[model samples]
Target: MSGARHREEDLLRGISASAGMAIGPLRRYELPLPRVAETAADPAAERQALAAALETVAATLESARHSADAQGQQEEAEIFDAHLAWLEDPALREAAEHHIAAGSSAGQGWYAALQAEIERLRQSESALLAARVDDLRDLQRRVMAPLAADAGAAEAADDDLDGAILIAREMTPSQFVAVAGRIQGLCLAAGGATSHLAILARARGVPCVMGLGEALLSLTAERAVLDATHGVLESAPDAERLAALVAERERRQAQARSAAEQACAAVITRDGRQVQVAANVGSAAEAQAAARAGADGVGLLRSEFLFLGRAAAPTREVQRREYAAALAALDGKPVIVRLLDIGADKQLDYLSLPAAPNPALGERGIRLWQTFPELFETQLDALLLAGNEAPVADAATPLQLMLPMVSDVGELRWVRQRLAARAAELGITRLPALGVMIEVPSAALCAVSLAREADFFSIGTNDLTQYVLAMDREVAGLAAHCDVLHPGVLRLIQATLEGARGRCPVGVCGAAAGDPLAAALLVAMGVDELSLEPAGIAALKAWLRELDAAALAARVPELLALDDGAAVRAVLAAWLDASAPRGFGVMSERRGHTHNKQ
Candidate 1:
């Protein structure tokens, strides 16, 4: 482990949470834990004390959630939602009750319960589950401090962290939120790449590296070079390396400024073919960010954000408000909102779905909607109501509705009939365009038939690649195999376009769309639109402006003939190295390294 820590010699190794470089003074910021007694004198009083502490924590989390929502910080609000859910979990309560009944104090019982839960999660095979251990520890501290009457752990410090690289054993989401903007970068001794801290760091464009273990905690150097792009921390850099890093930092800043300046410009290939660059957002905040980043439109509005991680489904009025807020953020830009695509990996405790051997291949998305038509109708009504509220300045770009997991034309027709019925019921005359998401092999194979009924087609490459390769996306150790750049997935994409036959615009909204290398190949294949996350829009557009799509088109036949993903990636890398413009060095080096919170 020590050898791995210094893999490159004199540099501490870790996983990159965000891509960037930062050279600054190192500052250690630790959140102390409250000590607790092992046993209690009164069991009844201990139980009551535990109950009160739970209520306090829940109320605090709820307040934080509302504050985040009011501030248009959707991801920050969702982090609180997970904490609140844990507070309401029956298993967690039972675990604490058992400990209290065994003659333990409220703080001790809660601490033990959370520690056990954290250990269990750490033993899980899923990285997502393991990454949640910090959250559980956070809850333990929150509840324990209240029971122990210790206010020190929860108080905010006034320490100045400006332009300093923060070092910690682990960080909670709330802690990260408080110091996100003040810090230059982050280095965690124990944390996962998928942790909420990492997500916040990436979103804020803060250079971050995690999972360095005790080696990071042993660092006593006052200054360090944090190269998050390569996931290495250098405590002492020579004069020449320091100078090079400074120049590199200036170059990156200049590149970012240039990209932002050209974000709103049309992405026309050198050969004069226009390609739409849109954003895939989940909330009004994300949509607004996309618009500000110069996205042409919202290509995929993940409506599930409004429904998931809740005690109950959102009301029609609530749904209407959320949708309208997102639409208003886009102003006149086109927005495609996907219907409720839940069940499977995303489950609601209130809705007890039937158990399946493999949830990924089970009844999900449109299939689940079919089982609960009332839920479907409620969302449809809300969307139509929002659409009827106010007219956009650009009438041509209306709110469009998309259906997910449609395997054939029948599903498209079924959704269209339902959409029309709901619109008519609400006295709405102008129906939004209806589209189908090409995710399943059957749907891609039958794109021609479905295209006749649907208004547009969006390829969800994330799902399509997993299905095509017969790999479960959520399973550990399959990320390399589940890559969308595989020749098999590319072939399916080509087939989908061929089936569409220019009857409707074909857009790629999956994770691959955000990748520059994949984006170039997508353009080469004649894809009409590329929709990715908001932060990536500027860089992607800047890169796309340098390519000649017609010239790329001539190489498609050869690219499709490649045997595997590695081969395709090698070809794209060589092409980028030879053809990318001089000013796009950052963009070229960043290709094929897209990191998204899946």
Candidate 2:
């Protein structure tokens, strides 16, 4: 007899995360646990079972680590490493043994012990350790929940659910590692898009739907199609729907690959103006990938990754090694490293500060630097050392020094004086050009004064918009005013650029720079350079290559002349609508042809 044919169908969905389609097999995983009887008599055997269970968990973590490493998922591998450590901990094993001796079955004993530890940790005063302990306990429950179910079943169930929808109340990092490649799309009963699970999904290029409620329970194995982009769960999809979905997925994948290729190409404007494209990276692996992706340099190197979650402050030597590795990977490209910008949002017990009612407006960025001079000095010393030992390049790589959250001229002078003293102490001769981030409204207003003391200006539009409009981007109710295109925010940017007065170069390294229309508007306002996320490089470049900045510049004064925000936005929108279609479309459509012949 011939094997049954599998029919494909088309599925239409929403774009929940704002990216394009990604079609892969559905990979699913359920948290499993070992079976347990109500009564227990064999204490020695129970101990042995616990040890064996630990061994199994360790093996599972190792396998996951290896698989993630092979796939170039370093962050996933790190998650597994944490699981491995938890499984091997003597304290955790001892707790399980004690529970077994108290007359519980093996699986029950393990679950009980884990729950007790979790409760204790959650109640602890140390928020950092409490968070970690909660995470570990959550993983234990997820990893063992399914195994426990199978123990009660008549036969062993399959661990691998190839390309299946993962329907779960929640997912822990370790559970995510255990079923890494087996899941196609994830549907959680509850979670925010920025939650750890969603973050992991985005990083791994997996489709996910969070806060799906109890609708996930109705989904059977390999019988339902989940359109994550649109939040639709189609039970028993027809052939036509499946076929359409598959085709759409393929098209999306092709578009992403094409975009990536284009991002690696040079960024040139319609008038032949060239702007360097770079990536914002946080780790060694990311730095290397950014380099491979044809990023001109590292625009923002967030150093918090090294400091956060550490039991003690990372030694100067360790900090140096991390920075040095990133510099080496850039191969002499300028890497703008920002000092630690922690606050109530990211509180460290070691660097204790009173709990604030509003952290965003409280001690953060340069404020923290002023409060904790020693910590700031250590980081400054390490960064300067990294710059001194950085490899020589064919061209002079402008290793610009950037200070975050400087609101006035005094902050600039304070940072420079400290840098001078530190340099003299270290016996350094030359220093990299110093720059200040224009993120505060006051800084924007006082740009000309601040610019006199700095070598360059990089506008952080994210915070600038938030501060200017007095609107929180996270709050959906205020999203209308939170836009970067708001007249007030645009005026601030214009003023800052005008204040520079061609003395020092000005660039924008923010989400606004990545948007095609926003980039055009900024260029019109005379921004010298634009830095965006690596993924947005191609689309932004395509728009830039079609825009005549001189023409845009001519129109910008008129656009800004209007005092009404709505009027200004309308004029700019109308101008773009009339000019962009033919200009941008034709240029992007012909880019491949021109580049191939060259």
Candidate 3:
């Protein structure tokens, strides 16, 4: 047995929670509660304790709710508000009291009741409700942890660390709220990025790594370094390693600042070609940040947030206020708003949707809008009001309307007609430039026809790639096929661009636009604009400036002749590498060499 095998080193890995490095003392937060046996004797005392516990939970939730409101995290606050309602529920309270009276310890009784209620909720037909049930179960575990020992007290007492690593088997949203900005990094034994702790980490910009197995058990309160970039957790690092990590961190931060500065600068090619570099924002705060980052305009303003949680469709006034806030934050910059794209994947209670055997192929985007004509009308009215109210000096601010999931020219015409009707009702002579997302293969195939009816095109690569490959991106097994760099996907994009040439503006707003190599290919394909995350804008702009579009155009035929996406990527990479310091159009030497092989 000894000769056959040996135990491997115990190494743990997990999804990187945030995008930075941090070395800090471990601060384990364990919730506090009394022993089960201690509270069994006195029913009245147990009742009082339960009431106090419920009040404490209410207070904690309220504090979180207020914090979220102050920070303009309304959606986040809703999660806490739901928890508050659960705590105040008469059924839940009665169940907990009954358990205590039946001789269970106060803490155990409360936890048991909550867990049972959560389980019952899990049987709910609503997926959102099921997700909420899971959240409640997590909260119950946190609320009862303090009962185990004095360890909970130590965790609660750790409110003053300079930099601390939160070690937990799993953390509740409320627990994370309590620690808030006090911690630098978080390491969890279990939990995925969708967990409340991970969500909070992302919102707060704190470094975190979860699903570290039992690594949290081995960690000490002493300083430990977490390299989120490489998914490495270094325990008790020596001075040299610590210094190196610190220096590297500083360098990365400097790079990030430099990137931000560069992102705002004008995106002019070396040969004097100008292209607008904008942000795809989902919220008003994001819009403001993107504008500050030098976004020429908002290429895509998602309207899902306004529709997500409401019991009924948002009124025109409410939508107008929201749209106005987003436009105002942009300070008159163009905000290209995409009407609600919600459907099967993002089901909303307000909308009556039939269950589809294949939702991806079913009604979504413009289809959903077509089905619910009133919703579309309300949205159009709000957009028109916002546009009219916007300052006249920014009249040419390019507030284009884009319809999502438009698979054919007929869909485009239908939407345009509706848009015209809405405009007539609003006493407007003409509507803003209307566009269609070239997401479906059918749209790409018939781009010219669609472009004839629409004023512009924005490629929604996320859905485009999914549809082209017939693969679900969220499914782990199909992730490799989800690559936007695939030759088939590129061909679709090229076709779309070719179809839209000279007819209307063509922009790539999907994740592919952010990739340097992919952006080069898009430019080579004659794409007019590339909208991406703020961080990638400067780098992309730099590459675009260096690129000789004429030279790239000369090489396009050779690239198209290639059958494989990987091969095409290789050829592009080689061309970029040979072109040194070429401006925003320069490609990596490695990528150029790879492409040359093709």
Model 3 poorest ten-residue lDDT run? 589-598
lDDT (tens digit, per residue) of candidate 2 on 1-598: 0012323322222212212233333334454444556457888887776667677767777888899789877666656665665666667777877888988766667787788877786565433334455356555664454336464354343455556666676677655645646666676664444344554675665666655565555445445556554444555555665676566556545554655667667767666677766666666667777787767787777677677544467777888788888888888887877678677345553578756766668878888876788888998888777777887664343456788888998988988999888978999756767888898899999999988888888888877887898865443234334567767888899889989976787888776665555677787677877775455456565567667777778887687677654566567656765776453431121121000000
**Count of backbone collisions within predicted model 1:** 0
TM-score of each: 0.87, 0.74, 0.75
Best by lDDT: 1
TM-score of 2: 0.74
Off by over 4 Å in 1: 1-17, 24-32, 66-72, 88-91, 116-131, 149-170, 187-195, 209-242, 390-397, 471-481, 581-583
How far in Å is the alpha carbon of 66 misplaced in model 1? 5.0
Please report, in order, the local distance difference test score of every candidate based on alpha carbons.
0.81, 0.65, 0.68
Per-prediction count of colliding residue pairs? 0, 36, 28
What is the lDDT ranking, best to worst? 1, 3, 2
Clashing pairs in 1: none
**Alpha-carbon RMSD, each predicted model:** 4.1, 7.8, 7.0
Superposed model 3: Cα runs more than 4 Å off? 1-59, 69-171, 176-200, 207-250, 393-397, 534-598
- Cand. 1 TM to true fold: 0.87
Number of backbone clashes in candidate 3: 28
